[model samples]
Target: MLLSDARSIGRVALPLYLSMVAVSLGALVNTAALGRYGTEALAAFAVTTAVYFPATAAVAGAVRGVMPFVAAKADDPPELLRVVRNGTWLAVFVGVPAALAVAGAGVIARAGGVPAATVAQLGPFPLLMAAAMLVGGFGSTATSCLVGLGRSKVVMRAGLAGAASTAVLSPLLVWKLGLNGAGIALCTANLVSCLITVSGLRGRLPGRLGRTIHFGQIRELAKVGIPMAGTVLVKFAVLGVLTVAAARVSTTAVAAHNIATGLAGLTFTAAVAIGQAVVPLVSTRTEGVRRAVIAGLTITVATLAAICAVIVLGGAERLFTDDPEVRAAVAGLLALLVVVVLADGLQAVLGFGLAGLKRTTPSFVIFSGCYGVLAVIAVPAAQHGLTGLWAALAAANLAVAVGQGLAFRRASNL
Candidate 1:
């Protein structure tokens, strides 16, 4: 049964995992491209993305509100189409405002307390990020449709397409247009993913796509997704604070933090992919959900530990930057990241496990209450420099791990 559960989990997770890796690879490639551009540009990319990622993630979380329902309707094409149509509409409704927010991320980031110089250097970056955010939000909705229907290979293909675009475009664009070129690369990649996934989703629909949107289905998806978005918002809000703390230390520290985070994010996606797989499994296979979650946890831990070893021992950090100062600055941050990444992976799976049980409300309550209190420590830690700030982030991620893990127990039981 354990093996079967693991296989089931893997069947669902592998494509999802690869897709996330491809997506993350795009960002890392952009980082490498910008790193060669200059330190100031890299620092601006770091801060702009710090805000951009969280905003897009929040919107993605809200779009995920449709997954459990889509899974429930998987056998019924008409109903599934209804669910997904509403979801895409939901994506459009929320995504527009989120893009606007991303467009002004420099000012918002300034308010969030990143160094003003970093913010000032963010010319044309906010607009580019907003463009990526808008396109990516819709792509996330389409990807969720595939995930719910066990069509994750389509998602993988879309992600590879996006990553390929990034690989080909980032160098050319950055070489020609610098920072704005990076943003254009990201936006174009998202557009490719959006087109491919939406095309895949179309084949599953029994009839022509709707001309009119339905508010009721949108509300239904929002009901599940909103609190989850809140949970994600709170967690990343702490990350944003940590960015401020790093910014306070020095531009070098903030840039290093972004590099470490990019590395960690690549591994963290494995765990999150497991959680995304868990949602439909737990929602459908009531008895097997427990085994699925356990198997996912095991898979996540082993995968991350291996990734940590490979990154640390194999000299992969050089791939992220050509800058010696940035490389040296990032080395210390990597040690601290080993612990933070594992803790984050644990919390992410548990949070997704909760989502599987359709119990996202507790997730929001726990994250908001826990992270809100713990995030304040980042301010004081900034005074002590990079190590102190990372430790504060570790504490916050650890506390969230515990809170969300405990919530999963109670939620799964109920």
Candidate 2:
């Protein structure tokens, strides 16, 4: 049964994994390109990304909460169509506020105590990314619906298209326009991806187009999604706070932190692919929770272990930047990521498993409480320097992973 479950998950996860890798590569390329401009530009990009990702996560997470519901009715074409329609509405509902929040990036950066010079260099970068978020939210909804319907290949293709566009356009824009060029490239790529994914959905699931927004369905989605959104928001908010603390330290620390984070994101996406694979299987199969969780953990452990080995053996620091100081700093942070990535992988699988069961509130509560405590500890730790900050983050991931693992055990038993 375990082997069978693993195979099933692998089938779904492989394309998703490749797609995520492509997207992560695009981010890595962006970071590398931005690094050429200067440390100030890199730091500004990091700060803006820290702010932008959380807001987008909140909106995306809420819309993704529709997946389990959609999967449960996968055999019913009409019902699935209705769920997709309502989920689109939910995307718009959450995305507007998130876009507004992102538009105020300059104010937020200042309040976070980012250096004035870095802030000045940021320009219209934040506003452009905010627009991307609005379009990306719809893309996320369509992608989640396809995942729920076991059509992950469509999502994979869309992600690849976006990544390719970003990879080609970001450097050109940055070379021509500086920091703002990166933003323009991101917005254009997001719009293109959203159109592709949504169009694919229209082709695959043609149906009546005149249904009005159903508050009952919206409420149903929110009942599950709001907690999921809260979970995602809490996790990213912790990182945002840490980014602010890093800014307080020095531009060098911020640059090192972003580089390490970009590397860690590659491993994190592998975990996400496994979790996403588990979601539909858990929703559709009876008595599948235990096997699904085990498969997810197994794949996550293997994937991250391989990544850690490469980083340790290959001296992968040169892939991002050439600065001796930044490379040295990244080395220490990478050591911490060896543990953090495993813990993060475990928590992602467990949290998504709980969501598949429609038991998302526990994840929200556990992550919020664990990360809140980490936030309090991180402020003083940042004063000590970058190593201290990395240690604090590592501890936070461990705590959340343990908490969510235990919660999953209890939820599965129920």
Candidate 3:
């Protein structure tokens, strides 16, 4: 049974992992391009991107919520289209405001302290990135829906196309048009990805050009989506506080933080992809089977975390920086966060499992307590300064994972 479940997870998760890795690299391409332009450009990009994370994550959850629904509707094309179109409408509606909010926030970020010139330079970045990602959101939704339907190949193809385009275009744009030009290039890639995803999804999802978009489905999506939005906001709040604290530590510390975060994000992308695969599977499985499934996923997550720890702790400095102290500090920080990653994997897999069971409210509550509140409280309270921040993250992740794990086990029994 364990072997069977593991095989199933692998079948679903491996392609998802590949796609996520490509997406992470695409982000790196953007970072690399901005870095080549100079520190100011990179700094501007970091601030703006970090600021955008919460909104995007929250809005993106709507799409995440749709995955299992689409997966369950695999045999019913019209149902799939119903979910997809609702997601499309929701993306368009939410994306515009999200862009405006992020743009406004960027303006305030500059007003508050960031540099006048840097702020001016950052002006177009938020909207452009948001717009691009808005398009990417549609593609992501489509891909995720496809994955839910056991169509992982389509997701992988779409992601590879986007990553390839971003890698090629980002540098070219940076060379010709500078940092803002790179943003434009990214937007183009996202639009291309959206097109690819839509094409791939053709004949899979129901509803042709004639079907009117359903307001009721959008409302139903919102019922689930609003809480997820809150969860995203909590995450944003936590990161925002931490980013501010890191900036106060030193500019070098901020840079180190960003590098470590990017590395960690790669791990998370894997977790999310795997967790996404778990959602539909768990939703459809028996309780005993679900427990076994979660166990397998937890082990896989731990293994991946260990691997990430070795790579980052072993040699990330070689790739990311030259400063010995920053290297040491960053390595130690990443090592601590690797434990968090382990816990995060467990939480992620089980969290989505719970969501698949329609038990998302508890998850929202648990995550809020663990990440939102506990994280905020613990990070600043750490005695070791920056290391304290890492400790806080580790504690939060472990706490959340343990809490969720217990809940999942008990719920499965019930």
State how far residue 208 of model 3 sits from its true place (Å): 1.7
TM-score of 1: 0.86
Q: In lDDT terms, which candidate is top? A: 2
lDDT of 3 by residue, 220-246 (tens): 666655566676688667766776677
Candidates ranked by lDDT, best first? 2, 1, 3
Q: How many backbone overlaps does candidate 1 show?
A: 0
Query: How close is every model to the real structure, measured as TM-score?
Result: 0.86, 0.88, 0.89
Which digits, one per residue and each the tens of the lDDT, describe model 2 over residues 1-414? 888888887888888888878877787778878889678878888878877888877887898788898889778887877888899999989998899888888788899788898788778888898899899899989988888877788888988998999999989988898788888888988888889888887877758635688889998888778898998878777887888888889998998888777778777888888888888877776686888889888988998899889986798878878999998888878778888888999999988898888888999898999899888887799998889998898888999999998988998888
| Model 2 worst lDDT window (10 residues) | 202-211
Q: What's the C-alpha lDDT at position 3 in model 3?
A: 65
